[model samples]
Target chain A: GAGVSQSPSNKVTEKGKDVELRCDPISGHTALYWYRQSLGQGLEFLIYFQGNSAPDKSGLPSDRFSAERTGGSVSTLTIQRTQQEDSAVYLCASSLWAGSYNEQFFGPGTRLTVL
Target chain B: AQSVTQPDIHITVSEGASLELRCNYSYGATPYLFWYVQSPGQGLQLLLKYFSGDTLVQGIKGFEAEFKRSQSSFNLRKPSVHWSDAAEYFCAVALGDSNYQLIWGAGTKLIIKP
Candidate 1:
């Protein structure tokens, strides 16, 4: 009965450093998503995974932002050579299935700070 | 281009006062709309959603929303708001044929007064 869970509630890294945020989706949730919430801004879509494969990576801001899912359960969002602009709360969500109707359950976000 | 707009950047209401948050979307097709609330230091929580039905939809925490195709609007309403309702409200639209792409609004911050 666990909801989505994300690790390392907070991460502070220097500019140009790399950080990996992890997410554990609820059991049987085939659809996983990653999002970024910048200060004073709305949530920015990052990537989505159905099972262990990602079909839509367009939301990724750049090559530096990448995400992957494995075993259809866990996901990792990696930000390489982070910049100040990348300092934000990284959130993950999962749903029973992928589509417009399904409600996504969100996890407590990982607050990443790039100094 | 698809976009969701929340015209009010902030709204303040006393506890027990009526509340209405406006949302408008620009899309030719009938869209799936959602209202989410994010309390400070917490994750986003779904308030309600409108896929297609009787237009009026009820959701958790004593909230409801009406989808008006005539105006391309889906406004959230609560007859009486509690002090704990003070938070950020976001309007979003699910677009694309199948990819779960959601277009989000800038969000409206709600303040509660005693």
Candidate 2:
């Protein structure tokens, strides 16, 4: 089976621009999550969607960062007015279900560089 | 607030040497623990996970981790490491049954030398 996949393996954009990253989870996954990884740092939780429940946006760093999952499969993370600090690897992951502990499958990730 | 700690930022060892990566979590009760690995230019892969029952759980690539409730730690160990085992290891914890939101440690970089 195909694992999680992300588009735009690498993206370079100027500061103050907007960029959208896409993620395609497994066929039947019900939970999708987004995270950010800075150089030599750990993964920072961003947002997650579980089934039909309202997505958890508490981990979103700021209002400029938002994500949406359509039809419970694909997810898109949008950054409005991106800053140089936004430069990092944006990662997406999916698990079998949400209620219990399930191993998360991660995508290769999209590296976003803001110059 | 809950947090995961990986004390070592980097560790260097020769090939075929024993390895151990430390992980600790701060929580009111035992939570689900996980160890993930990321190779260069690759995505994160689950090495193993600890939920309940046995304290020692084995994982892929000759890796295993022991969960200690008293110490609040889940340490990863490998008896003999190959050069290809070099990569970054992360420790994460899920608060309850929900596994979507996980608290991650800073990570430890393993350097293998032949």
Candidate 3:
């Protein structure tokens, strides 16, 4: 019954600092995804987790962007040495399975500002 | 490359007026198309989708979309729009054979006037 949830609805930090954004997907959702929404821009896919299969990191911008899904549930997206360009809303979504048809339920994003 | 385009960056419509949001996508093969709506300060919500079958498909919230292969378009339409319909709309395409990878458009901001 619970929807996807993200922590720290807002975060502000200095450049070069590292930040971790957490996402808790809905129960029984085997597929989780992380996306970034920049100002005046569209949502960019980051990483995807589906069951025991290897995660898809192709959309990750760089090495600084990394994510891990522990116990096939919660996921954390870490931005190391963050830059001003990384200032945006980090969004998380989950679906019943890893497919194109199932709808993804999103959580209220975490708005991050890099100073 | 797979991509989606929402030609209109912004659309303005009076309340109770007809609404249509254009969406075009480019993919190597037949793609799965979807339309999502997002209200300010909220997450994205699915409006409708077109996989195959009939050319036209209906969805929740009195919305519907028509998929045209020749034009590579899946435009969302509503006979009448409500004030609360003001929000951002995104057109997305899922790669049919790319393990469900989705390519999203920049999004269109809808402005509803009373």
> Model 1 captures what fraction of native contacts?
0.55
Residues B11-96 of candidate 1: C-alpha lDDT, one tens digit per residue = 99999999999999999998889999999877789999988879999999999999999999999999999999999999999974
Interface RMSD of each: 1.6, 1.6, 1.7
How high is the lDDT of residue B48 in model 3? 88
Each candidate: what lDDT? 0.91, 0.91, 0.90
- Report, to 2 decimal places, the DockQ of model 3: 0.66
**Can you tell me which runs of candidate 3 are displaced by over 4 Å?**
none
- TM-score of candidate 3 chain A against the true chain A: 0.95
A best-first ranking of the candidates according to their TM-score comes to: 1, 3, 2
Tell me the lDDT of model 2 at B45: 98
- lDDT string for model 3 (B20-93, tens) is 99999987677988999999989899998888899899998999999989999999999999999999999998
Instruction: List residue ranges in candidate 2 displaced over 4 A.
Output: A52-54
TM-score of the second chain, each candidate in turn, equals 0.97, 0.98, 0.95
lDDT for each residue of candidate 3 in A1-106, tens digit (9 for 90 to 100): 4799998899999999999999999999999998999987778988789963546789999999988888888888999999999999999999988889788899
**lDDT (tens digit, per residue) of candidate 1 on A1-115:** 4788898999999999999999999899999999888887778898899899999899999999888888898899999999999999999999988887789889989999999
> Which ten contiguous residues of candidate 2 chain A have the minimum total lDDT?
A47-56
DockQ for candidate 2, C-alpha atoms: 0.74
Distance from true position, residue B68, model 1, in Å?
A: 1.0
